[model samples]
Structure formats: C-alpha cells, structure tokens
Target: MSVGTIVAVCVGNGGVPKHPVAEAKVGPDGLEGDRHRYHLHGGRDRALCLLSVDEVRSLEADGVRVAGPGAFGENLLIDGLDFSALRAGDRLLVRADDTPIELELFDVREPCATLRRIDRRFPDLMLGRSGFMARVLGEGTLRAELAIERP
Candidate 1:
C-alpha cells in the first residue's frame, strides 16, 4: 500500500495566468466541505493538475517548488504516489469520510518547456522529466486519507 499526504490545496478560475494562485472551493459544486477547485487550461473544465508527494520532494530538492494542488498550475499535488502507474481509463477510488470520489486516470501529461519556465526545477520533477497530468473520473470530496483501487 502506497501512502501519501496532501502538502497543500489550491483553487482558481479561468482568468489569471502565470501561476493563477490556488484557492479553496466552498459550497457544493460537487466539491465537499470547503474544498478549493483549480481551473486548468482555461475554464474548459475543472480537475486541473495533480502531483505526488514524492514529486514535491523532487521539486524541492531541485530548488523549484510548489504548494499543492494548483500550486504550480496543478490541481492536485499528491505525495508518494505514482501518477504514471495509473493509466487512461483506470478508475481511482478517492475516499474521504463516507464520501468517495471515483477518479479515472485519463492521460499521460507530457513535459513541456513552459513548465521549465515556471520553475527551472520542474523539468526534473517526478514525471516532470516526462511531464504530468490527470483527469477526474468523478467529482466530489477527497480528503487526505484515500486510496486508489487498481481496476
């Protein structure tokens, strides 16, 4: 069982650019209990970016740093989790209290020079060497304690 921690949480809309600054979402737009939502690639959709806790360390070590979820334009900054291992069409069980948001891994986020511009250390960040991305299969409350069931 791979364990991880949420270093930070962020949310934003489709207006700001160049590190839009993360925010916390309140009310029930599907998110639970004051959960913040981050907008990625414009307001085309929700569920922005994700990162592994281990990835956080990788970035920190490199000098390039990010807060968590939307910190560096990523919606989710997970710790000690491997995003690559979860492929497209894979169902991820996001558990929190009695609420569990089922997330489906959609695609492999490829690396780009832009990431390097944001943080020179990004190019080497966990999948940063390969780039990172994620698609939410379902929207709901996702607490710190949760696990993904391999489908």
Candidate 2:
C-alpha cells in the first residue's frame, strides 16, 4: 500500500526561502498565502509540490546543504512514500478533521537555478529527485504529521 506521513508543511509568499508552517488551508488555487514565480510555477495542475523526507536525507548524505523544510520549494514534505512509484494521475488522500484533502499527482518538478544558488550542487543532486507536482482536488486544513494514503 502507498502511504506516508507529512513531516512538514511549508510555504512562501512568492519566492525562495519557503518556511514551515504548522497548518494551512489548501484549495484549488493551492496553499493559502503561498505564491510562486508564475513563469515556471503555480498553476492548477501544479498547485502543490511534494518531496519525500527520504529524498532530503539522501541529499544531505551526499553533502548537499539543503537549508531545511521548503528548501526544495515543496509545499509538503512527506515521509515513507516511494516517490518513484508515483506517476501522473496518482491520487493521494490526506486525512483531515472534516474530510480528506485529495491531491492528484501530475508531473515531476524540475530544479531551477534558484536551487543552484542554495548550493552549487543542488541542481544536479535533485536532477530526478526534486519532487512531484499535484493539483488539489479537495480543500482542507493541512498540518504536519497528517497521515497520507493512496486510494
């Protein structure tokens, strides 16, 4: 079964240096108050970005200094899911108080030059591991440690 737990939730106003937040509202337009470069990020199909904690650990082990959560520009940092197993059209359900927030994975995120600025090796280290993008199918409050399951 595909399952994971949100280790962290991050957001940024419009650029790099996305910081972690305790909770946030996720909607069709994406996380509340979150913004993107527009030219290469943030659209319906690319509403939310996710990266696995495992991926971060791997990068750290490789000596790439990722600042912290949101370092890769992911809105959600999850643990225990094999990101490689996910493909376009895969659905993820995040258990919330009233109802689950559903997300549809659609594409792999490409590392941008901003990453290189963080660490000259970041771009290459995240070549195929940057993360994946998704669209919000259902809106709900998202928090860290929420259980994520594939249905």
Strongest candidate by TM-score: 2
lDDT of 1 by residue, 1-151 (tens): 4444444444544221213223333222323222223333422123444556665565667776454345454555566556557555665555544655555555555444456655665445535433244445445544444454444
- lDDT by residue for model 2 over 1-151, one digit each (tens)? 7889998889998767788999999999899989987656898999999999988988888887878898878899999988889888999999988799999998988877777777887677788788899999988999998999887
Model 2: which residue pairs collide?
A: none
Model 1 weakest 10-residue run by lDDT: 14-23
Against the hidden reference, what TM-scores do the models get?
0.59, 0.95
> What shift in Å separates residue 123 of candidate 2 from its native position after superposition?
1.8
Q: What is the lDDT of candidate 2?
A: 0.87
Residue 128, candidate 1: Cα error in Å is: 4.1
